[model samples]
Target chain A: MALIRKKIVVKNKQGLHARPAALFVQVANKFDSRITVSNDKEEVNGKSIMGILMLGAEKGTLIVIEADGEDAHSAISELEKIISAEEEK
Target chain B: MIELKGIAAASGISIGPAYKIGKEELVIEREPIKEQDIPIQIQLFEESLIKTRREIIELQKRIGLEMGQEEAEIFDAHLLVLEDRMLIEEVISRLKKEKVNVAYIFSGVLKKYIDVFSKIEDEYLKERIADINDVGKRILRHLLGKEKKSLGDLKEKVIVVAHDLSPSDTAAMHKQLVSAFVTDIGGKTSHTAIMAKSLEIPAVVGVEEATVKIKPSDLLIVDGNKGIVIIDPDEKTLQIYGQEEERLKGIAQRFLSVKDAPAATIDGRTIDIYANIEFPDEVPSVKLHGAMGIGLYRTEFFYMNRKDLPLEEEHYQAYKYVAEEMKPYSVIIRTLDLGGDKFLSQFEIPSEMQPFLGWRAIRFCLARPDIFKLQLRAILRASVHGNLKLMYPMISGIEELEQANRILEEAKEELRNKGIPFNNDIPVGAMIEVPSAAMTADILAKQADFFSIGTNDLIQYSLAVDRVNEKVAYLYEPAHPAVLRLIKNIIDAAHNAHIKVGMCGEMAGEPSFALMLLGLGLDEFSMPPQVIPELKYIIRCVTFKQAQEIAHQALMLSTGREVEEFSHAKLNEVLK
Candidate 1:
């Protein structure tokens, strides 16, 4: 299992809502790995656009992205790019 | 002709066939499923989800092709909702546990999700509840094998009839194809009114059973000027309305000529003409109509059309934008006046026997200082942007006025501690809507810097008549002896107390009532921007002395009908 976990400060001004959240979910769905994202208290399936949005992570919010399975490394990197990019990827 | 009455929302007359919009409520009863049927139920849910997804994509593609991609992007949120793994899994899990029909379980789960989202304080997420509800309805319709009508993709112009038009429904409306709107439930300040005014279309709301009475394509006459909708009018009546519509167009052109003139009586008494705006989008139109200032900048929109309470910054930003836009002219904002006919589910405002007489306006604000002070603080912060003033609506007496001011002071103190600069001496006013407030105008005027008579509620409170009830609509007369007497006393009290009195109501905008109100020494008149030029024309045409004389004669007459007739006659005579 190529499990990967990394933390990143939300760089996009709109946090993970709108186009950014959609893009993150779309990328997460492409992975053959189980992906999850967590704020401080709760973790949710990274493949859910609603879950990402329901987190209500504003700009500068610290979130951890975790992926478990063979393509975990790639999924983590791709999802991380969405939240880290100042503009939509 | 069968006539039904409602509150006059946006004024004008339109003759068109009816297009009834039925209430979109799908009742679902839980039916037990056997253990063997669990897989079948799951399949049903999955198929409906797939169907809903395809329908949304088709709609998105069509809307993109027709209205451009920017407008079609609103459905992106809906698509996310349909594909939400968390939501779908929860429904399937609950369906197995509950052993209930898939449709019932699906709708129930959707309700829970909606509850969770609505409870979220984030404004962006709060806005998403509309999308969720929209998508939820689509999925349920598919599961139940039912189809419901939506206000979408209209082929021709028609008068829309509905039980109630929600914020989203109004937003989804084909503005060009809908000639007018008639709804079963809503007051003058409801969504229908706000949308109708912004759309510059005629609408009659609170016409009970309008959706029931008018069939699709029924020939109709919607006289928003009188708040009456006639279904299946005969030849003569239709001809009369057709001529009246033409005449009004001519009058509109005539009014445009004097739009830029100051509203002054021939005998030299000047009345400040202002616009009553619900939101900032109307500011440009307010200027076009030559309003000297914004007299009643209603802040209720913050609470309306959404689930969560707006953040203080939202209020501050909007108020600041309007205040900056109307720099020299004063903007009088009426604070959050919830309850009564316009109650929010978020507040859990109870159904009252007489909502208008129950907890509302300043009463509701006084009880909820946490909510009230947040708004007050925002208003205070935005006060520095221009000539901004604030007023409390439905203030019945001195106690409510003082309590409200005490909270305002607390807001000021909070701002002061933060070193936020605001207009320290911002003028504070109290809206005289209740009879008690009108009777004690002198006492209120002591603490109040000014008074804006909200004649809509004043006439309702004075006559003890429910404004929305068509059976008693005749009793809800603005020119009733009791109503006029209360108004006279209020104006007199404000003048005696050295505070100016203005009116922001339907009565203030009516051309027939303009002269009498001028005679009563109303210092200001605020209404929908479209009515400003017409009222200004009436004010400019008559001498204040002549108006006073008309007022004197009209007051001597006992009935509201007589007073109205006299005012109409005098208006025609002055124009001649």
Candidate 2:
């Protein structure tokens, strides 16, 4: 199993707010990897809505998204797109 | 016919088929399961999760069809919460070790998540706590086998029976579909009771086992005035209540007939008749009931029923709406009286032994000037909209009053520095709720622009009786000699200082108490909007001189019961 971690800056105006967090959880569930996201200080399960919401990442907040499994690379790339997007998809 | 005794929460009578709402099952009963039942408990947990997922998916589809896709998207988060492996695994693992019912185990796990999310200061995360709680409740409900019906989905008019209704639950009710309601718990001052009064519907509360005793389509007769509910009544009993209901309807019409007239005595003494509102939305009803203005606009609702602190703009808009609506008339806004029986998770107020006597009301505001001045600034900004007044609750002496004013001055200076225009001379009042405040009313009134007696707290403090405690509720009499003396002292002091004194308490809305209060020379009377018409009718029928005579006789009575009976007789005589 491959473990991958990437420190990505949240560029969305609202950061990883409700819509972004929900979208992230949906994408995270598709992978066999165990995903965790942290705002440097406090980390939460990237796949758990409650945990992802607990990070409360605002715009310009730096978060580290970690995925550990065979599909870890694809999970990080997919989530990175949503978090770095300027507007909510 | 089975008769259930309850507290008469609202007046009048109604007969209808009972429509019971399955209890949402927030409180779970922990049944210790045998070791052999572990597999069964595990199966129950899995089944409930599946049921909750199906329910959410079905609801989402329906909402998508009805309210559109955007609104339906909120449920996407709920579905993920149900699928959260960490949460589900924790519950299943805990159940096997603890060997308890799955419903109880699920509630404990749910509470843990809610508590964790609630502690975080982030606003976005705070709102998700509600979603977590909502999904958790649905799962718990299924585990306990409750197929609940939403209050909004009533097809026919029926008497609503429940364990209790929250403010939001009552808000969801359609007035026409809900002819009346009877709850298993809650007292006279509960929000359910208050909503029933405002809805102009009959209700009986505090009926033990009301939900269990009355079944759906059981044919219930709710006698709200007498605090009685007859389940499946006989022909003779039904006929009696049917006529009694009509007689009450006629009386209600008479009360409504006096709606437009000012509440003035026969001898030309006009008192300011006002309504006490909890929400800004109650403004239209205030006018419909012929209230001169809003006397007490309890601002705690801005804090309650929500996560995170309210922005200054939100407070300003609410105050501005009420101020403009009641333009040329006064709207007294009592600032955040947060922590007495109100669970304020936002403040994280340290749990106290005696919350009422402990750090509460003005004390909480004084300690947190950041929160206090935020509200004060909003009130000041809104004051320019129309006639608006602000009052400080639980001010015991001149020191607290002076301290509050000092903060008020800082708020004013901030506005001045920002060059924001507000009414510079907004009437600042003191609420005489504490015993010390009542005693020192003369001193406080010297600086206060007005005085509003909050008899609910005043009586509780003076008599040393917890109003919520049933055992001491008998001791919590408004007509108690000590309470009357304090009120008399307060009114006398306010008048002595040339400031108008009003009463915005349970005592203010009551007919006999209103009669006694008028004689006591109270300049204003404020109560719930629904009570305004009857009070106005009573005021118009009697001369001020006669009320003074009744008050004089009541003052002479030694016991509270005697004073109550004497004043009640005087009120009946005036109405006759």
Candidate 3:
């Protein structure tokens, strides 16, 4: 088992919200890692759409992503890719 | 005849029998149930929730296929609220503890949520309260064993009289069968009103007791242009309205004959006729009414009724749809003209004492470059699809126009750097709505490619009259000497700068004012698509010389009344 953590700024126009948030959760759920995302104070399960939405992370906000499991690194990177992508899906 | 006054929601004249849409009242009574019956009550509630979910899914699918995916996404919120565990569990808890009927407990829980949601200071949250209420009402209706009434299968042409029409109700209406809409409650910007305008139907909303006084099959006359509804007219009144109706139809018929003809005066001076549209769906009406192009494609609607800001892709798709649909005809997509009277729930703007004069339109956009640049990039990308032009709204002076253009250049540069394909030569225009903008139009025109006089705001701002305020609304006059002078000044400035000027406002749509505007040297007239044909008819009937005389006389007039009287007489004389 491995633990990975990364801090990233939300670069997408709408931040980690709405469709982007759903995409993040979808990517986070693909691995068996325990993934969690947090802003300044609030931490939410990265695999839950509602939890990610409740974070209210708007564009340019600093967020922390953590994943712990065998595939933690890939999960964290894939989830980061979804949030940092500039163009809308 | 009994005349009822209301807000003029849509402009048209419709005379027909009243078709009253009776709203079914849901009767919820608290009946204490036995302990054994509690499980059955809970079962009933669950069944109703399932039923409501199914109905919403069906509506979402239908609206997605018909309107757009964004519009259908409104139901996604509804579905989310419906499946919310907190709300359902609260209702169930109340039913168990209070030992009351499911309907009563559910209503109480729904009301609590509505009250809490409504109290939120955020406008987006406030708007979402409507969705919660809508979903709650659907479940309540099912729990009470009542079916929601629909206006889908209207049998004949009739004037629909209702208390108020919900968005879903208006969406479900048989547009062809309903000749007009007269509602008991709604302002000019209400959902019903916007829907009426989009459907191209006569609508008189905010007429309190319209549903009470009007009966089914009662003869009704809805004068949407004047916001008056006449019910059960006398023979003399009927004769008068009958003649008026025939005259309007005759105008429509006469205009249709010249639909394919160019908008040229008797002396062969050509003037462009265009349509002012709020949605891409209106492009067909623009073509059907013989509009050469869309002069003002208001992009504000893209920012409406949603929590999230519109993505660049959404804006691009909308502009591309209109541009491709119009093909050879140009589509002028105006930037997001939010703030003031048209506040977006997504934008948290502080309430201003005088909103009309407050931070609005281009000022708001300039302050938020991120949002403004997104829209600009979308418009630029879409421009390559057709003859698309972009414009800014409420630009007060040269500085604002320059700043807006600077932002546009930045957006273009970003797209270029990204290797995105866009029309680099897209024409840019600015709206002269503020008195300051109209006064310094020449200086502003030097920076912009063209000018559009938005007379609705111009008249309101110039005269210092809040058009929405019924008491001072009469002071907002388009024919006022000062207004005319400002319009003339704007046109002269634009022309002197070698830029074409157009008017896309209520003043341009007015037939009596057509000669005056033409005489003022307006190169184009853009108005509601429905009025384009009549304006074209007026333009073709009069010569440039005649219009010039009318304009000169109008400028010399002392009062708005005198200008109105003179323009009316001259208009009838020239056209008749």
Residue range B361-394, candidate 1, lDDT tens digits:
8888899999999999999999999999999999
Model 2 has an lDDT value of 0.85
Task: Tell me which residue pairs clash in candidate 3.
Answer: none
Top-scoring candidate (DockQ): 1
Writing each residue's lDDT as its tens digit, candidate 3 over B1-576 gives 788999899988888999888875778888999999999999999999999999889887876655545466667667766766556777888888989999999988778666754554443444455566677888999999887788987889989999877666766877789989999976776656767776767899989899989988999989988999999988998888788878877866898788778999999989999998887766766788889999999988887544467889999999999999998988888888887667464665665677678888899999999999999999999988999998899998888988998999999999999999999999999999999999988789778899999999999989988887769977888899999999999999998999999989899999899999998899999898778777888889988998999899899999999999998998889767
Please, what are the lDDT tens digits per residue for candidate 1 over residues A36-69?
A: 8999977988988777876768889999999999
Report the candidate with higher DockQ, 1 versus 2: 1
- Give the worst 10-residue stretch by lDDT in candidate 1 chain B: B63-72
B-chain TM-scores per prediction: 0.64, 0.68, 0.73
Candidate 1 vs 2: which has more TM-score: 2
Write model 2 residue lDDT over B1-576, tens digit each, in one string: 999999999987999999887765466888999999999989988998898888788877765544344445567777889998778888889998998999988899888778876776655565566567767877877888886556888889999998877543554566689999899977786656766876778899999999998888999999988999999999999999999888888877888898889889999999999999977767887887799999999988787533368999999999999999999999999988877655453555554667778898899999999999999999999999999999999888899899999999999999999999999999999999999999999999898999999999999999999887778889989999999999999999999989999999899999888889999999999998878999998888889998888788888899999999988888777776
Sort all candidates by TM-score, best to worst: 3, 2, 1
TM-score of each: 0.57, 0.62, 0.66
The interface RMSD value for candidate 1 stands at: 13.5
Q: How accurate is candidate 1 locally (lDDT)?
A: 0.85
**Candidate order, DockQ descending:** 1, 2, 3
Native contact share for candidate 1: 0.34
lDDT of 3 at B562: 94
